[model samples]
Target: MYVLIPAYEPDMRMIALIESLKETNPQPGIIIVDDGSGACYEELFQTASRMGCIVLTHETNRGKGCALKTGFSYLKGIGASGEVVCADSDGQHLPKDIMRVGSCVEPDSRSMVLGGRRFSGKVPLRSRFGNSATRFVYARSTGVKIHDTQTGLRGYSTDMLDFLLEVPGERFEYEMNVLLTAAKYGYAIKEITIDTVYLNNNESSHFRPIADSASVYLPFLKFSGSSLISGAVDFVLVLLLHSLSSSLILAVWGVRCISALLNYTLNRNVVFFKESGIRHRTAFPRYALLAVLIACLNYLLLFLLYKKAGIPLPLAKILTEIPLFLLSYWSQKSFIFTLLNPNG
Candidate 1:
């Protein structure tokens, strides 16, 4: 196994962690990325190098995601194939836990093993709340429940190097993107419980709560916003056209046609925006097909809810959308804009 550590403006604790890892039985190859810690931290990195860690340096501070990619790229270039485990340099992860995560990386099983931390002890307020909120949003957005979406200690086979390099996000969001992409592509994520260690309320962490949190949550929020805008347009068009024409079918078709066009555009351009290498020729037809199916379902449900169910027209419209909203989101993510090779 190769251990990848991304360090920025780190202290002696980083060197200590390196030495401890060296002491492990069957020590793994260590790669420490110097994310522009500058000359002041040169001596510490030198010590890590002397301790048999291949230290890669960056002239300027790249974010954690960039640093990790640098390490992965280095490993790939060297043709090193085995388990690659990523651990934080802040000493929050125990050496034993790192080894445990490394051990969990199975060559045959194409899955990422995460060292899941349960924030049990006196955890930082921001750490606890940020993790909780991220967990909830991640689960709802991907329909995959990952308890520790923010954990840095994760292990995966070298075969995932190319995929990880392709995943977007330059900072904290990159990790979240990895998990989201994994869920979308059907990559199994196995979590191994590890000891939770918070040093000085995790003050050593360089994560910007507001900025990083926004990056992490931006995808889901954009998806929700696009859906809301489309739904609003659909609702308004349905009511206005229905009131004027007194034809439910006409109203539903007209509203959905317009709304689906707008939703597809927004989703393609903004929400799940990426250079997917999938053209509109391929995606549009699938999306349109889904839209038609959804429109038919919407009309049927609305008709039943408003007519037979005795629900108010407005209430029925809202009720009809509740379930379809989830269905639309998942469909777009899973089938429409999904990666061609999710397992990678």
Candidate 2:
């Protein structure tokens, strides 16, 4: 196994972390991709080298994502291949936690293992909310109930490293993007809960609250935006069809069918462009089945609320719309979109 750490003028805690890693049994090969921490840190790299660690420098700061790519490529180039674990330089992650991640890595299986952080104890307020919000949105968009998507404490098989070359984003957002892309490729992702310790409350962290959060949450926003457009289209078409036909039920089904097709088309082609390989022929039938399932559920709820319960029609519509929209989004992102292109 190989351990890769991307450091940028790392503090003394990094040295302690490296030392701890060296003391572990079945000593793993370690690689530190220094993102241009200049002459001041030359001695630190040299010390690590004397301890038989591979020290690769980036001359200039290229961001964490770039440093990771360099390290993975280097690891592959040298034939020291197997599973690779990525740890943060800030020393928030424990070296022993690698064992938890290691236990989940199957020799022949292609999966990404992530260390789930337990936020039950003394965690900062912002950190807690940020992680929780992101997790909820991510679960809705990807259908993967991962506890922590932002943790750098993760393990990936060498074969999965191929994605390193294709992954975009240069900073914090890169890791989040990789998880999404990995899911798109049919890779199994599992989460293992571990201790959460903020070495310095991440005060010196490079992550920006609003700006970086936007990058990390981009996919969720895109999904929400797409759903909004599709919902509007669905409602408008339904109203138009109702006006065209005397039978309100006929208009409802017709509008739903048309809007579903439109939503699927836009989501597959635009939102998740690289993963739209469900063979147009096979996709429609499966999508139609899913659409019908949603319609039935929607109709049942609408009827129960508006007629039986005697709620105003508009209020009942709004009540039913919320749950319906959520169910449809999750089903589409996880099952429909995923099946459409199983081998992306």
- The alpha-carbon RMSD values of the candidates against the true structure, listed in the order shown, are 2.4, 3.5
In model 1, which residue pairs have backbone atoms overlapping below 3 Å?
none
lDDT of each: 0.88, 0.77
Question: Model 1 lDDT vs. the true structure?
Answer: 0.88
Model 1 poorest ten-residue lDDT run: 335-344
Candidate 1 wrongly placed segments (more than 4 Å): 299-319, 342-344
**Candidate 2 clashes between residue pairs 3 or more apart in a chain or in different chains:** 278-340
Q: Count the backbone clashes (under 3 Å) in each candidate.
A: 0, 1
Please provide TM-scores, in order, for all candidate models, with all chains considered together.
0.91, 0.80
**RMSD versus native structure for model 1:** 2.4
The whole-model C-alpha lDDT of candidate 2 against the native structure comes to: 0.77
Poorest stretch of ten by lDDT in candidate 2: 335-344
